[model samples]
Target chain A: MSTTGTAWTPERRARAALTFICEPGRPDLSRFVAEQGAPDVVEALLASSGTAAWSRRARCLDLDALIARAEALGARLVVPGDDEWPAPLAELDRIEPVGGMCGAPLALWVAGRRRLDEILRPGYGALAIVGARACTRYGQALATDLASRLAGQFPVISGGAYGIDIAAHRGALAAGAPTVAVMAGGLDEWYPKGNTRVFEQILDEWAVVSELPPGMRPTRPGFLARNRLIAALSAGVLVVEAAMRSGAVNTAHWAGALGRIVMAVPGPVTSGMSETPHRLIRDHEAELVAGPADVRALLCAPGEQLEGPWMTPTRPLDGLDPRLLAVREALPGRGSLTVDQLASRARCTSAACDGALVELELLGLVEQDESGRWRLRRPR
Target chain B: MSTTGTAWTPERRARAALTFICEPGRPDLSRFVAEQGAPDVVEALLASSGTAAWSRRARCLDLDALIARAEALGARLVVPGDDEWPAPLAELDRIEPVGGMCGAPLALWVAGRRRLDEILRPGYGALAIVGARACTRYGQALATDLASRLAGQFPVISGGAYGIDIAAHRGALAAGAPTVAVMAGGLDEWYPKGNTRVFEQILDEWAVVSELPPGMRPTRPGFLARNRLIAALSAGVLVVEAAMRSGAVNTAHWAGALGRIVMAVPGPVTSGMSETPHRLIRDHEAELVAGPADVRALLCAPGEQLEGPWMTPTRPLDGLDPRLLAVREALPGRGSLTVDQLASRARCTSAACDGALVELELLGLVEQDESGRWRLRRPR
Candidate 1:
């Protein structure tokens, strides 16, 4: 019989065949495979003493068709000993089960121009940006901005779905950076047809990955299994926005159980989209990150400062005279105001307010409009 | 010599006199007063041994005039060992100085019908709400709502300034509960003038307190000293909204220094007004409180649940099937959508979407308009 490629050793073939018959994230099956080896586990499942369901699926599987489908999609199966396997996934073997699901994927079907191993090596790691599929505009904008800014340094990774996930993918593409799309089903058909364009763009530069074989549709259990893979493949996971009950929260759970840095961006407490992020932060289960700088701060080694423009404590109005500060605060956020109006609002004399405006203008903190009204200068 | 009232002992008079000549928060002076006693300290300052600034101010002091001024304002002095002095202020005596300011006031000038001691006794501790004077409508609204909800159980404490401070004071009064306004200047005249009406209302029910005498005006340093008193008088400090450099941040520092629970409400990250609160929450320096219930949770003894409607983890969408959840999430936040639109958005077939919608409708998670378009039910 013809094989998929020279890289398809007996071990690789066994792992690939197991993906078709055995479900992913089964801790007991994973343990059995780990101790006895994939080939031996497959042999046991095919024997008379094996579970009826596993034996039936094992016997009916068509290996040749699976191999041909993988090749047709430009995907390759990577097993435990392959050079392309992610080192971070090793953590999955040691972590406790979540929702009765645990263990590293038996083999991942990966397709891309770049290697997964190189993308997730030490010093250069991936960050997973996951959130609700029905995200708000604020959440989408923030996720896109954060991903675009960080993708050039660390490749962005996310599920191939809409809302925050698609936005993150588009952001990386906008920045001309590579990004990975970890799908919940067979990557041959990027599940959400709406984001197929984004998936295609990602596949051109980075990769589309999954644990399932071709021709399989995504199930609810498959989605849970996919979240674990996303978490295990990244150094840290940043939850942009999520509801009280969301898949993003589940991904965060997996990240936490894997000992990965779990960070969340805060939005208005008034928004339902902020529920999961706020809950994570309030419970101390995740670090609060306002932007990319905060994410960098937590991901970096201890004692290293998060170096960015925002890291500086030098605010424009810091250390201003109390009178000047009061005058500045009195000015409305949008419109300009006359000295008299400012003084009335600031509760100071008009002369003092005028003097403060002059000083503030000199310091580049305020400006005079054509109408002779003073306003705060926009900060650079 | 004529005295303010029977409560004005020689020791009380000495403490009262010190307020006229000395600034409120001098760590060294506070240590001196603590050790030497207020009467001896006054005599020493009156003698040639006093510093030039202290001696000049002390020598010209007229006891009868001060006493008469106190009675005319309907205010009285509450010295250490007095029944009306807040026991929480004792914490200030043991805490380290922040920015060269420390220790409790020698005596507080207070005005109101309720005894300060009774209001701040063990069971009925106060919460301080502080923020920017030029706060956003969001901040002001949140402050008002939080204070109104919490004041019935806990007397609200705040500064008598224009924005968040006055809003908090007004909210407490709206609840028909007594609230304290800690002033930077003297209680006899509330500064800023814009908030005098609110201050007058507070005096009718609660109290206005300060360390300065009747003739003193608020200076920059006096504002810093006033922050410590607000922190010292409360069980916790809730910063509603503040810029990066704000007096509210200063109060949070005092609260932290005094080991008081420091909590902050989160707003939109796009707003500059949220800077201080976001920073405090990100650095783990302050707990994030979305509402009064969160405040109650932190203030309660460890392990006690924050008992409120929000405390229940039974969300409307909890334990929902994946198909129904997807359909629910697909419905637009505001408007209704056709079945085809939802099915397309949820990446499900029209038949499956229709079935899921029926289940969701039965569960009261979604509703259909007269047009037969489905929409998510607004969470109550």
Candidate 2:
């Protein structure tokens, strides 16, 4: 499938896949579908050889009613290659999926004005805040503070499970940034049911969405499915609270496989909830983040945001080279410029300006990170 | 000058170095101290060249106490290369005590039953469990569980601070294994004071120890000093719970420099308590541990606990080949058979039996984590 855009449509591929997985031995069929691609996934289900595996792919669920329900909720279906699709998730196809960790979304049904891809900026990458269903006050408070502090930077993504997940979504909402919730079951049912009011409120402002088929019920497996999406869609997945054998770790592993940043909050070594994140980090699968600043800096990463030509400084007009002086004077409001752009404006080729930009960067003549497209270095 | 395990007794020398650190244009004293050997470090402090630095070191109350109180506690000041020292802790000597990040101990006033050297068994290593002072339930629980489980196989080390520290010590004690509590302050005031019961108990049953001297109240800097000891004395350091810039991670970095395994217990990504561990693990500076089995399997590192010898039963049976067969036949319940003692009775030469033992090990017939000179391998 050419992934530039337009590959996904309302084909019930998600429902088809769900139907297939719900059957006996069809879980293994995911491998075949992944290798063969989506259309082939349906073909495999239809194949006589695969009939024994799923046996129920032909059973038609009322897909239209489900679509109508989501529509009534004002949700939109986000498929692969769509303009709003999360590009980082492309790693899902390249990163060798381990176990059932492969993340190929049938579609991410969304219900908000916020675009999934836009939130995943170079510096302010999306933060996935997930944890135990039974999080403590320590976990809740920390989650709230982190989400609040990071509100202006990274929007939070989480399951609407109680405890840490709810805390994260609440934290982000409080920060006035949209938080997205990926549900385990159909967005219609609101699996926990208790969080229905919160879900409606969230739907009103941000997004409450899922990959599960419209009528599909939440199961242990569906939770697993939901987790992979949460991890895959973000630039980094941060597990707030996970027990020794938590499902949250499965998400972390998916993020690791996708090469997305996997971060885990550490807890008392005594708590069962702290185990999974510790394991992910200790195994060198994730990065530790202290707060918004660390996450913000890392999200910028190496070579992401450049401040100057980062090659050499342009000499001043005081006995300095004329080319350097020209470029330096052209800076608007003391704004910085890169070598190539500066070269064009200074009436010189990039070769000459590159050398000048480096000196400026080192001399603290410019600042970087907020904009890779350089800026005048402001002193602290 | 020699590491008579009493190097810190030359108190004037340590004072002088502290003085130098407190002087002008000496922000990088840790690097300088690290370059100098223990005796050289002590001497540099005592010489006239260090007078400017000495006055600064002399002003600190804890600095004054380290010389006198460290001795009073029956704590022989242990430094790197001392015969009575732990090999794992050799890394501490490499760090200069600047900004409390990489400094090796000026001296470790150890007071306990287990000598540092004896516990430094090649295979059975050490681990440090550290975390936030105002830790969460999740954080505390994880720290305790990790410590208790690891205690059976390796010594658990910690800062002996509040929250997570208290939990780790209690866990180890509950497991009936002695733990090393590396304190920031002198033994007199257990800083938090709430932990006085356990602190005093440790001095009796285990050991409440530090690099600082007796009566030296824990300064923010001294607490940082205590972190290095926790890092160095262990084969690895496990950060249980910490905010992004929390002190526990400093120990992790120290352990990283020491080339020790750094592990972290993960919590809810939402919880700030988990920030440090997540950061360390995410950055690949620490390993993630899910449970006791995970830590034990990693730290104890059970190698090929499979059954079966590589070769056939025996090729070179010597004279007692048939007798060795008889001994095998005579076995009812599993038991240990001393090399010569079993050989003499079986009428086989000790040399022949020794070869068989090596072969047995290779074949996976028996395994040994307890390295021994003539150790008996339990039957597979």
Candidate 3:
């Protein structure tokens, strides 16, 4: 266990202890974690339980040792104070001390090409794609499309799992966008071994991360626990395809809890793989996203469209020209005001008003009847 | 043409006119209708623009004549004010009027053994089954399963088209929940003609509704328009199977807009037809639904738990001792309290406090740790 970096401090011990108790209740882990962070209690538990064997197990999996394992591989340990820390993650601690799969990472072990702080800064597009381990072609294709296109635009975050998640990572990697895989087990072992090549490829070009210490084996619960971190770290979560009961649904729940946008793609009626995402949308728990435009709405920074859709330059009022702003302002109420009435009120000669009206009409502020009566056009 | 009862009055004409304007861009037609109601407007438009004479080519079809045609077959027109109007349709007035492939109907014409309105109510359990006109065997099978079994609980709403929709209708008819075929054309011309027998069977026992007038052919647009009414009039919309751009996608979209629950049965990843619903879920636009339980959530009246998952009831509190109350009061503000700490504040014997705390824990108000700590639980 002696690889690199400093030894585990008492505070670091508490973080490891807290996460162990964070498991679905020995009926009281939350209270204990709340009173004193889990790591703090782990120190006490080992001392008070008076079990020498248990204390040895705890010391064997020390945070410093865990950090050193990654450090030996040229990785950096990012605690809450690091500039690279994601602010959205810290928000998770306020609720239930640490909750769901989306909890703030106690410490992140990063060995990658892209910098975490760079992506976290405004303007870098990052999306998380997660779904059923068993997915339909629809899910795979969409996951690939999103990952490829989004990675070209921004980095993509996801768990290094199978099916939809794997496709998302592969898609982004192929498109040359930075991709990150958050694992449930230690980086030493990529679960499903088949994805090891992809996991390696991602680490070579981007980053592959894990909250767990080295040598820890994967379990069903650990995978469930991994979903929250996936949701918490991304700007939004896109469920590719999943069973109604899949962990992707858990990711969606975590995203919603974090106030992060949750989006799901739809599938054909016959695909069992699409159930999880469909359930979220049908319940109004998530938005129906058909394309990247929908995801853009959920994002924080602006893209493209600078002048905005509504803003227009003011026209000259002095001109006798009807194609200017004078005719538009001359209209009485927002309701259907007739053009002829506007001309009369604006004191513009009928011919001038008519010309101005056409220009205003081009600007989309007024409309006319089939019979040629003029009226104010309501903005859509 | 003989209707059950109608000589014509201002109110009936107003109701019919209201239905007409509910369609997109038809709001302009509202003023003309309001200025003259139905019969008078029809007569006025005819005289003023020679609207009827120009329509001899058949594009500007008369809606009243559509009603008159249904009446000739012993069917009556049902409007929002009608006793047979489906109440679920009330949602149409709230949203920004959904349109296209799945647009809502303005007036429904019915010739049926079962009342349309009674069959669509949530408590009665109506499920909408729709999909691509061309469907895979998997889709067809799921449609049948949904229609056949869920029919025992409620009526199945579907477009009386080919493939998946037809299969669902057949399943419901076989199950005896009383199915309704929302058509794209009038009852006189079954359009697809291949479905003529099923159309006729439904005419005698169920309903076939369309916003399109009688004698007017079912155009592609007409089919798109008819899909929405199917969505709005049902407790939930279920897409058994669909391609990326299939008609079932339209039905799902309408369901989302109407705020009615939209569910899609899952299928295999290999099928291309699974794309749309899978996309719906991935995009967070629809729910992944399986069997009757998923449908039941949509049909569940506000507060009644109907079958399966998330239906656990509150634990009861029949007995509470004072020591437990004191300990509960001593718990930290959104904080975790230990068992030993709780005992110190209770002003009672540690044994009594521990006993009281255990009962409180079982009742779910307070939770404790494996390390013998206790704390308040969040309300959720």
Which one wins on TM-score? 1
lDDT: worst 10-residue window of model 2 chain A: A306-315
lDDT of 1 by residue, B197-264 (tens): 88888887778888998878999999999999999998899998999999999999999999889999
Show the colliding residue pairs in model 1.
none
Chain B TM-score, candidate 3?
0.69
TM-score of each candidate structure, all chains considered together: 0.78, 0.54, 0.58
lDDT for every model? 0.83, 0.62, 0.66
The sequence of per-residue lDDT tens digits that candidate 3 reaches over residues B136-209 is 87778888877876765667788888999889988877665578888776667676899888877776666777
The CA lDDT at A89 in model 3 is: 66
TM-score of chain A of each: 0.77, 0.68, 0.68
- Residue-level lDDT for B365 in candidate 3: 75
Which ten-residue region of model 2 chain B has the weakest summed lDDT?
B304-313
Q: Which structure is stronger by TM-score: 1 or 2?
A: 1
> Model 1 chain B: which ten-residue window has the lowest total lDDT?
B305-314
Q: Enumerate the candidates' DockQ scores in order.
A: 0.47, 0.32, 0.19
Evaluated at residue B162, the lDDT of candidate 2 is: 87
Per prediction, the TM-score for chain B is 0.78, 0.66, 0.69
- Point out where model 1 deviates above 4 Å: A1-6, A47-51, A303-380, B1-5, B49-51, B303-380
Alpha carbon lDDT at B117, candidate 3? 61
Could you tell which candidate, 1 or 2, scores higher by lDDT? 1
